[model samples]
Target chain A: AQTVTQSQPEMSVQEAETVTLSCTYDTSESDYYLFWYKQPPSRQMILVIRQEAYKQQNATENRFSVNFQKAAKSFSLKISDSQLGDAAMYFCAYRNSRTFGNKLVFGAGTILRVKS
Target chain B: NAGVTQTPKFRVLKTGQSMTLLCAQDMNHEYMYWYRQDPGMGLRLIHYSVGEGTTAKGEVPDGYNVSRLKKQNFLLGLESAAPSQTSVYFCASEGTGQETQYFGPGTRLLVL
Candidate 1:
């Protein structure tokens, strides 16, 4: 079974600064997909970004980018130019590309606080 | 399109009581999933449907039963509620190979 781990339970970043949330996974599959999800206080789950294991280049989405290292099985999310609106619970998820249902195995989560 | 929607935004039930959570997607997605979220425990898959008339158990499907009689709707049922089952339930759907699953707003279930 594949598992994702987010070691940091909480992280804080000052406004306009950058913060990196660490994530590691245990997967034997060579090809898979990783994602970062943000859950706000309203309980809405939003997709922050994604990375494909086969892609060497990290994925970047505006202020959100990922550092995906396949050999190390590490996928970390970096939020730059952080804003107060970035406060939320961030989750790291793993999925098998060949598997059915696209079921996601998620980490416990990291609570991100953006300080103004 | 409403994307994904779960019926009964919130509900409180007692032990032994039974209820069904309805999840509907207007995107005509081919797959649907039911998951439970608890504090400190991101989310665990309870059940999933590959398509209409096809349902399968997920990581934590023991106490949950699901039916997908319609392509656009999936229903999860708890025959008898338990306090341990008290958690926020989420429903998600995606087209085959889409790589991204759209989640519902979630149903807050409280069992006492």
Candidate 2:
């Protein structure tokens, strides 16, 4: 079974600054996908970004980017020019590519606080 | 279009009570999933369906049941609710080969 871990339960970043949220996973399969999802106080889950294990280049979306290290089994999310809207609970997820199973395994989550 | 919608955005159930939570998607997606979110637990899959009339158990299916009679709708049921079942439930759907799974607003369930 694959499991994702977000060691930091809470993270704080000043507005307009950059912050990195750590995420690590345990999976024996070489082919897999990693994702970061954000949940605001509204409790709405939003997909921030995703990275494919086979892709060496990290994935970027607007101000959100990922640092995917396959060999180290680490996938972290970096938010640049952080805004107050970035405050939320961030979750890391994993999915296997071999079975093409749509099921996702998620981490406990990290609460991100953006200070003005 | 309403990507995914869940019925009774908020629900309260007493132990031994039975209720069904509805999830409808207008994207005509072939895959639908049910998950519950709790404090200290990000989200856990409860059930999923590949297509109409096909339902499968997920990680935490012990206390839940699901049905997919129509391609656009998936129903999750709780036969005998418990306090442990109190949590927010989310419904998600994705295309056959699509990587992104669209999520619903979510239903908050409180069982006493």
Interface RMSD of each: 0.7, 1.2
What DockQ, between 0 and 1, does each candidate earn?
0.85, 0.72
Residue B6 of model 2, lDDT score: 93
Q: Summarize candidate 2's per-residue lDDT along A1-116 as a digit string, tens digits.
A: 88999999999999999999999999999988899999999998999998989999999999999999999999999999999999999999998876533789999999999999
Question: Model 1, A13: alpha-carbon shift in Å?
Answer: 0.7
Clashing pairs in 2: none
Identify the candidate with maximal TM-score: 1
Query: TM-score of chain A for each candidate?
Result: 0.98, 0.97
lDDT of 1 by residue, B1-112 (tens): 8999999999999999999999999998999999999989989999999999999989999878999999999999999999999999999999977988889999999999
